[model samples]
Target: MVVDLVVIGTAITLGPLHNSAFILLLTAERGVRRGLVFILSWLAGLLMVIAAVILLTGGTPPARQSVPSTAALAGKLALGLGLVAYGERKRRRPPRPRHAPKWMERPDRVSGWTAAGLAILLQPWAMVGAGAATAVDANLSSIASTLALTGFCVLATSSMLAMELYTTFSPVAAEAKLRGLRDWLDTHQDQAIVSLSLLLGLWLVADSIYQLVE
Candidate 1:
C-alpha cells in the first residue's frame, strides 16, 4: 500500500509537468482561481487515464519486460526529432500579443469549477499515469490507502500551484528571480527545449532498442 501510494504520487508529479496539455493550460491562464481549476481538471483526467489503462492491461501494471522493439526505437527517434523541429519552428515565430478571453478579462466572473474541468480534460499525461496506476492496483481494496494515494497526488501537484501563486502575488519578486532565467531561455529557447526533447527521445529509443535486443 505504501509502495502504491509512492508510485502514484511520483507519477502524478512527473506526468503533469511534462504533459503538453497541462503546460499549455497553465500558461494560458493567470491567478490562483485558474490554477485551482487546472488542478481539478488535471486530477479528473488522471482518474480517467487510470481507468482506461486498467481496462486495457487487464489490471496489470506495465512491467519493464513489456518494453517495445528496435523498430519502436526508430519510431521514437523520429518522433523526438519531429518534436524538436516543431519547437524550433515555434521559437522562430514572433510572439503575438495575447488577447484576454471574455471571462479572463472579467476576473470576477470566472467560474472555478469550469476552469478545473477544462484543465483536466485538456491534459493527456495525467490520464496516462492515472490509467497506469489504476491498472496496477485494480485488485487492491483498501479505501484508506486509495485516499492516501489521492492525497499524495494533490500534494505533489501543489508545488506547481505554489509556484504560480508566488508569481501571481509577488510579480515584482518573481520577475526579478525569473529575469535571468527568462533571458537565458529567450536567447537559447530553441536549443533548450529541443535538447530536452532529444534527450528524452534518445532515452526512449535506447530503452526500446534494449528491450528488443533482449
Candidate 2:
C-alpha cells in the first residue's frame, strides 16, 4: 500500500498541468496568498478522497479474496487499463501545437476564489483516483499504514508547497526560475503525460494482477 501510494503520489506531483498552473499562481499579484489557497484547496481534495476511503474501509484492510477486496483490486485494474490506453493513444498521436488555456491567459488577474477553483480543477484526477484506490488497502490501525497515507498526502502536495515557500522567501529568484520551469513543462507536457501514465499504469496493472492471483 505504501509503495502504491508513493508511486501514485509521485505521478500526481509530476503532472505538468497542475504544476504549470501553480507557477502562474505564484507569479500573480498577491501571489503568496493565492498560492497558499491553491495548495490548501489541492490538499483538501486529496484528503477528501483518502478520508472517504478510510471511512469505507473502517481502518481495516478487507479480508483478502473477499468480495470487497476483489472489488477494490478490480477497480484498480480497470483504472490502470484505462490509463494505459489513454497514454498509448497520446503517444501514438502526432504532437500538436500547444496553447495556454484561456484561463491561464490572465493568471495575474485571477481572483482568490478562482485560484482555489483552479487548484481543484487542475488536479490530475485519474491519478488521484488511482491513489484513492490504492489507499483502500490502508490499515489505519497500523502505524505504518497511517504514516503511509500521511506521507502520500505530503508527497503529493510537496511540489506546490515547495514553490509557495520558495516564492515567499525569495521572490526575486523564484520568479525567474519558476517561469523557466513552467516554460519547460509546457514544452514537454505531452511527453511527461505519456511517460507518467504508461509507467504508473503498467505498475498498477501488474500489481493488481499479482494480488488477484496470489
Candidate 3:
C-alpha cells in the first residue's frame, strides 16, 4: 500500500503538463491569488477521483475467498496497458515544438476562477484513476486508512504547494528562479510524462494481476 502510494504521488507531482501550467499562472499578475486557486483546485481534483471511486465501491472489499476482484483489476490492467503503449508510441515519434495555448500566453489577465478551471481541466485523469484504484484495497472504514489517503493527497500536492508558497512569500525574489524552473519543466515535459506513465502503468498492471490471481 505504501509503495503504491509513493508511485501514485510521484506521478502526480512530477506530471509536467499541468505543473507547467500552474508555473505559468504563478508568474502572472496577481500570481499569488491565482496560484492559491490553482493549488486548491488541483488538490480537489485529485481528491474527487478518489471520492468517486470510494462511493462506487462502497468502501468495502469483497471477501478474499470470494471471487477475486477480477473486474476492477482488469479495468486497471487495461488502463495500464494503454498507458504503456502510449508512452512507447510517444518515445518512437519525433518530438515536435508545442505552442502554448492562447489562454496560457495571456497569463497576466488570468483570474482566480480561470486558474481553478484550468486545474480541473488539466488533470491527468489516467494517473488519478490509477491512484484511486490502488487506494481501493485500503480498508477505509478504519481511521488509519482514511489518514493514509489524506497523506497521499498531501504527498501528491507537495510539489505544487512548495512552488506556490515560494512564489507567494518572495514573488520578486523568486521570479527569476521560478522561471528557470518553468523552462526546465517545459523542456522535459514530454519525457517526464512518458517515463511516469510507463513506470506507474507497469506497476498498476502488475499489481492488478497479482490481486486478481490471489
Candidate 1: list runs displaced more than 4 Å. 1-33, 61-85, 88-108, 121-158, 164-195
lDDT of each residue in 1-214, candidate 3, tens digit only? 6677778788888888888888888888888788888889988888888788788768876555344356666777888888999998888889998887998769989878889999888887887777776677677788877887898898888888988888878888788888898899888988998898899889888887887777
Structural similarity to truth (TM-score) of each candidate: 0.49, 0.97, 0.93
**Ranking of candidates on TM-score, top first:** 2, 3, 1
> Which of the two, 1 or 2, has more lDDT?
2
Model 2 / residue 60 / CA error / Å = 1.2
lDDT agreement of model 2 with the native: 0.91
TM-score of 1: 0.49
Error of 3 at 146 (Å): 0.9
Candidate 2 lDDT over residue span 132-178, tens digit each: 88888889779999999999999999999999999999999999999
Q: Of 2 and 3, which scores higher on lDDT? A: 2
Best by TM-score: 2
Residue 130 of model 3: what lDDT? 74
Off by over 4 Å in 3: 65-68
How do the residues 68-104 of candidate 1 rate in per-residue lDDT, one tens digit apiece?
Answer: 2233234444554454455566567676554534654
Best by lDDT: 2
Judging by TM-score, tell me the better candidate of 1 and 3.
3
